[model samples]
Target: MSLQDLHGLLSNLQRNPGIPLDLDWVDSIRVNRSAAERRAATLPARRTVKKKYQAAWLLRAIACMDLTTLGGDDTPGTVRRLCAKARRPVRQEVLAALGAEQLGVRVGAVCVYHQMVPTAVEALQGSGIPVAAVAAGFPHGLSPFAQRLDEIRSSVAAGATEIDIVITRAHVLTGDWRALYDEIAAFREACGEAHLKTILATGELGTLTNVGKASAVAMMAGADFIKTSTGKETENATLPVGLVMARQIREYLDRTGYKVGYKPAGGIRTAKQSLDWLILMKEELGNEWLLPDLFRLGASSLLTDIERQLEHHATGRYAATHHQPMP
Candidate 1:
C-alpha cells in the first residue's frame, strides 16, 4: 500500500446492508485453534518495518484508531478533552519532524458512552471525526430488548454517526443462532444512516470456534463492523481471536460480495502491537482493510505509546511518558 494513501484517512465506503441469515453457513463455521495460535505467534517475527516506513505505518494506525473514553467517572469535560486529543493525535513537533504536518492526521472516531454522545459531537463539530456511542447496556447486553433499541435510537438522534452495540452472549452460548441474528438485525435497523458495530465480547463466548460462528451471524445480520470485545471483558483482544475474525471477514466477502469491517479493541496498548494488527490486515484481507472505514483500534492509551514511539523515531532517545499524556 502506498504511504501517500494514509493521508486521506477515512473513506466513504459503502455500508454492509447484510444478507439473509444462512443457518447452514453459520453451522459450517469452524476454527482450528492450534493453527490460529501458531500463525498469530509467527506473524510478528515474519515482518519488520523501520525508519520512514514504520513512521508511515504508525501514522496509518492512528488514522484507523477509535480514540475512546468509556468509564463510569467519565464527565463531559473529560469527553471534550478526549475529542481535542482525537483531532490531533500526534504532537506537532513529531508530525513536522516526519514531514507529515500537513497530512491532516487524525483518529478515525471518538467513542464514548451514550450520555456523552452529544458532548463528543459538539466537541468534534466540523472536524469530520465521527462520534461512536456504545449502547445496548454497553459491556453487558442484558438490558430489556426494547430498551437496547431505544438506546441506539437516542444516540443516533443525539448526532452519533456510529453506534457500537454489544450482542447477547446468552444467545451465542445457547447455540441460538437465530436469536443472535435477530438481535443484531434490530440494532442495525435502529442505526438507520448511522453505522452499526457489533461487539461479540469474544472472550466470554467460550471458544475460537464460537468466535467464528458469532462473527458470521453478526455479519449475516448486517453488522457494518464486527468488533472483538467491549474492552471490559477479562480477555479482550488477542491475536488468535483477531485471526479468527479476519478469516470470517474474508469468507463473508467471498460469499456475499460485501465487505465487513473488523476491530480489535482492548489490551492493544503499544505502537508495536498496532503494527502487528496492520500487518495482519494487509496480509490476510489486503490493503483496503487498512483504512479507517474497514479497521479500527478501540483504544484510549494506545495513542500515547504511539506518540512516544514517533518521538523516539524523530529524535534518537525516548522522552518521559508525561510528555504524551492523554486526558
Candidate 2:
C-alpha cells in the first residue's frame, strides 16, 4: 500500500493497551547470542530490493523516520528548521518525478529535547506530525525517580504528544527486574494519553539476554514502543541487537496479543542500513510492522542519505552530500 493508505490504516489501528505484568514470562526470557549474531550477519547478503522497488522501500523508510535534533546547543531556530524539514522531507522535484507528491509523504515525527517541544509543536502545527520529546533524564537516565516522572508530565504539558523516556540501566544491570518494571510503569502512568517509548539503552545492558528481558519488561509495564538506545551509548542499534528486540516483540505478540513498536536509534546513517532494518522487520514481523506507528528510525543524517539516494534514482546521477543538507 501507499504511504497515504498506510496512514489511514494507522489512524484506525488500536494502540497496545498493556496488560498486567507477568513475572513468570519475564523471568523465562533467554537469548542465544551466537545464533542471533549469525542470523543478523546473513541479513545484508540475503535481502536486496533494487531499482523502483528500492525507491519504494526508501519512501517507506522516510515515513518511518523520527526526524531528530537532540543536542545540548539546540535552539528554537534549529528546532523550527528541523520541523520544517519534517513537514517536507523530500525535495519537491524528486517527489514529483516519483509521482509521490499527492501521497502526503513526511517523516514519522519530529524528536527534540523537552525544552524544545513547544518550538517543534508550533513549527509543525496542523501538519499532523506529532512532536516527540526525550524526557525522564534522557541518555543516562540517572536522575532521581520522582524527578524523572515530573519531567515526563512537564513535557506532555508542553505539547509533546509522545514521550521517549529512558530506563535506568542499573536496574537491568543489577538484575532488579521489579525495580525496572515499577519505574517504567510509573513513566507510562505519567504519559497518560500520550504514547510512551521506553528506551532500553541496549548498549549499556551488557548482553543480548539482558536486551531481550528488558524488552519484555518494558512491554509488560505498558510501553507503547521499546527503543534500542539513546544515541549516546558507546554502541547503538546493531542488527544483532535489533534481531533480539524484534524477536521479543514477536514473542510478546504471541503471548499477550499486544504488539509493541520497535525503534533502533543511533548510528543508522545510510540508506542501506535503513533497508536492512526494514527487511528485518518484514522478515521477523510481517509488513504490518512497517508502518510509522509500529516502527520508527531515530536518526537525522539518515534522511539526508535517503534523499540523496532517491535523487540519484530519479536523475541517474549522484549528488554531493552538501547539495542535500539537513535543517
Clash-forming residue pairs, model 1: none
Error of 1 at 177 (Å): 0.2
lDDT of 1: 0.91
lDDT (10s digit) by residue, model 1, range 75-107: 999999999998888889888888888788888
Each model's C-alpha lDDT?
0.91, 0.91
Q: Which sections of candidate 1 miss by over 4 Å?
A: 1-11
